[model samples]
Target: MSLQVQIMDEIKTAMRAKDTVALEALRAIKSEMLLAATASGSKEELTADDEVKLLQRLVKTRKESARIFTEQNRPDLAEPELAQVAVIEKFLPAQLSEEEVEAVVAKIIAETGASGIASMGKVMGLASAQLGGTAEGKTISAIVKKLLV
Candidate 1:
């Protein structure tokens, strides 16, 4: 099933199961999808890649919020945000492990003939495209930097 359709179905299930965290997370996904579809100059429908990017953005936002809440010693607030992260993560592709990411970055560095930190941008551009939804950009960049140096 398409991500949007699958999300809608899950929303129904969450509602029936009275899963507040899942329900809230699913609703947020639905809302983001709607906004993307209707945004000025955007296509009426989102591609699968677009959906993955959207989900990643949502997860990243939640993670950052959770981090901030934790820093402030607000476990009560952070808990739901982290719960939402877990729920949203179900839709994302299985993330690459750090080792796996490092391997991929190493390969990209070789492919691009990247010499050192000066070629960081070149390596990053290629690595980001190659890894895409499989790994986070920050992780990929860190690996690239380590490999380059």
Candidate 2:
């Protein structure tokens, strides 16, 4: 099944299981996916890649909210955001470890014959396309910078 469909199933399961935290998170994901589909002029269906990107965006947002809440000494609020982050992460591809990301970065650098910071853009474009849902953008960028510099 597609990610959105899986999410919908899980949402139903969560509701039946009385998992408020999971239910809330799944509902928010459904809402975001619907919004993305509508925004893209697609007929209410999110493509796989689009679903991954949307889930990643939601996770990123929740992480930031959790960080801010923690910084403000509000663990009560932060916990829910962290829970949502976990839920959203279930839809993302298995994340690449730092070593794996570095290896991919190295391959891209060699493949593109990219040298120094000047070629950073070219390397980033290639690596991001290759890594896509498997890796976080900031992590990929940092690895690319470390390799290129």
Candidate 3:
């Protein structure tokens, strides 16, 4: 089934189970998908890669919000954001561990023949395409920088 259909099923399940966090997160996903579908000049449906990218963006936003909340010493505010992150993550493919990401980055750097920071952009572009959704951009960038330098 498509991601949208899966999400809709989960939304109903969450509602039946009285899972407030999951229900809230699923609704947000549904809203975003609808907006994307109806956006001006947009296609009728998102491709699989687009869906993954959308989910990744949602997770990143939640993580950033959680980080800010924690920095302000507000655990209460951070908790819900983190909880939503957890719920949203269930739909995403399993993430690459740091070690896994580093391995992939190393391979891409080798394949691209990238040397020094000067070739960082080339390496990053290739790595991001190869490792998208499985790894965060920040992690990939840091690994590329460390390897290049």
After superposition on all C-alphas, the RMSD of every candidate to the true structure, in Å, is 0.7, 1.2, 1.0
Candidate 2 per-residue lDDT, tens place, 1-149, comes to 77767988999999999999999999999998878878855766667788888889889999999999999999999999999888778878899999999999999888888999999988989998999899999999999999998
**Model 1 clashes, total count:** 0
Q: If scored against the real structure, what TM-score would every candidate get?
A: 0.97, 0.95, 0.96
What lDDT does the true structure give each of the candidates? 0.93, 0.90, 0.92
Better of 1 and 3 by TM-score: 1
Give lDDT tens digits, candidate 1, residues 1-149. Answer: 89988999999999999999999999999999999999999987999899999999999999999999999999999999999999999999999999999988888777778898999999899888888899999898888888888
Among the numbered candidates, top lDDT falls to: 1
* Segments in model 1 whose C-alpha atoms lie over 4 Å from true places: none
Per-residue lDDT for 15-54 in model 3, tens only? 9999999999999999988888899999978988889989
Model 2 TM-score (2 dp): 0.95
The residue pairs that clash in candidate 1, if any, are none
The alpha-carbon deviation from the true structure for residue 116 of candidate 2, after best TM-score superposition, in angstroms, is: 0.9
